[model samples]
Target chain A: MTRHMSESDSDRSPDAAGRSWHDMGGLPAGGINPAEHDFALWEKRVDALQVLCATKGLYTVDGLRRALEEMGPQAFESMTYYERWISAVTKNLLETGVFTTEELNARMEAVAARGATYGDASIEGASPEGET
Target chain B: MTSLPHVDPPAFPPPYPSAAPRFAPGDAVRVATGHAPGHIRTPWYLRGRVGRVERICGDFANPEELAFHRSGLPPRALYRVRFTMKEIWGERAERGEDTLDAEIFEHWLEAAEG
Candidate 1:
């Protein structure tokens, strides 16, 4: 492999001089446990939204990545993976005028008034006759 | 991912006619070492490093432009760049002989003498 692709004057600037937080390739990190956990219902919804939006051309994956990357390293440390993704997706949607911030705020308020837990807050959580 | 809304992935954009491919197979090229601070696909480690053009990976819309809601039309030619671990990692390489390849756009590359 080396023979086919010869090396040049590898003025290879070492990593971390001006690199961004998201570009973590070739960097030292912790060992991977290769664990697989079941995705939460909200995480599944976020994933589904990501796929649907991207497929529907509502926003490109690059747009979502830009949102994710621009959110800075602090957000990465604070938020879960899916949480950050949904945040990015929502940002992209809002930036594109898919819906107004006021609309989102109102909808959020409505959702919160339903219940505390995720399953309980969902519409299906309510009985057919509106019983909890 | 696309700039236009409601269009499916299959309808994003076809490979633009390159007319003539710039870097052919086995050509030594270097990834441009520029950081514009926007959505970039080129990894930082590979920037400014020399590599061989393994194969032309066809042309597609530039992600950097598409991310900003711009029509990345007149798609750029994409190539599969190959680099040795030694070339990228220097003395810190686990296996100097091992090579890794990445699909990079033409605008991110320039011709180099091997």
Candidate 2:
């Protein structure tokens, strides 16, 4: 936007320019129509996880932002906001040595075996262990 | 006693003595064109843009370092810099008079010159 900008920034289309993927402040995009939304139970859980993790000194909020940025632009375009957040939070927890990869994968498998839908799986202790 | 379980060792950031403010309110400054990759609080659009220091937002832990689990020691001064829409969008600005404010850490700023 100024003379100080590099030729790469001025020469190419904003998308192709050597620009940080997340830096789209002045780029042409869709109209903004602000709207209120009711939080889903899962989304609230994600939020709570972030807050709890921060309070526990496991990671800073900035650490969570780093994880989100690391997910890349494809994930940004595809994943819902809270979905990205949960993914990021999970990653930071893993990085901090809170749990091992094998532990996480095994837990994920156990959870997946619980039921076909998230709602069915969420019912505490409802899983018929090793049904799969 | 046997080692306890279920308690996670806290990863708290080490306390850092704060740095003094370099620029004062109403001083002119420019945002640094920092391209380092990591979790950055400064937005890309504001890079190389010149603005006026609207106010001092006090010192805070450096988020860039904090993001990597490092102690953000020697806290930096935070400032609310004000930029005109025209400066950011050129002639495409809907109104040149409109302004945007960003909270920037001291390290991202430099003395502005004509």
Candidate 3:
């Protein structure tokens, strides 16, 4: 597997002094590059899969793979049970001086509430299926 | 020396001995036993890792038995295992915070050092 540089490494480039920016493909230096960010995203999704598998009693390998595939990376990051992964990802962002924990938590809470509303609506819509 | 009355060898104990003491929440364990072929719940990546027990999930009824296959075996117990992020991902994990959890079968557990 090809190893990518960490966020810190991306910020500083040995090739350029004073220039401060280096481009390897489309990704730039300074903030979390797309590749590193993507890895973090994938890791968070996997962590969420682990949490879901554990909580739902879906421990089997096949169950985990299916859950991961279904949850997708974005959905996994937003899941309430996988909040720890969200916190960790947010903490990483915070250490980079990107966002405060309180702010991130608030944003997550809002997103979760919206998701719950949507889920409830979907359940209500499906209620008529078996009602004879 | 003449042998006394010949006695049959003590019947070999059951091939897969029942899990010693069902796993419970808060137990520290490592995966130590299993031998089923094909896809399994416990991946090889997590085989020897140690983690804290988060919950004692109930017995696991074999999925195969429900689909018209043989049906004499009892369900296996399940446990939720929590591992530190560092243990699973090493330096890849962020510093300070450390933990992740996975559901595992009781057969996967062995005593882990504190």
Whole-model Cα lDDT of every candidate shown, in order: 0.76, 0.75, 0.48
Ordered from best to worst DockQ, the candidate numbers read 1, 2, 3
Candidate 1 lDDT over B23-76, as tens digits, reads 877788888988778888998878877888777767788899889878788788
lDDT of 2 by residue, B11-65 (tens): 4421332357788666778888776777888887777777877767777889999
TM-score of B-chain for each predicted structure, in order: 0.83, 0.82, 0.65
Q: Once superposed on the true structure, which residue ranges of model 1 sit more than 4 Å away at CA?
A: A1-17, A120-132, B1-19
DockQ of each: 0.28, 0.27, 0.02
Report how large a share of the reference interface contacts model 2 reproduces.
Answer: 0.60
Q: Which stretches of candidate 2 lie over 4 Å from their true place?
A: A1-13, A16-18, A32-37, A118-132, B1-19
Measured by DockQ, the strongest candidate is: 1
Considering TM-score, which of the candidate structures 1 and 2 is the better prediction for this target? Answer: 1
User: lDDT, candidate 3, residue A71?
Assistant: 43
Q: How far does residue A56 in candidate 3 sit from its true spot (Å)?
A: 23
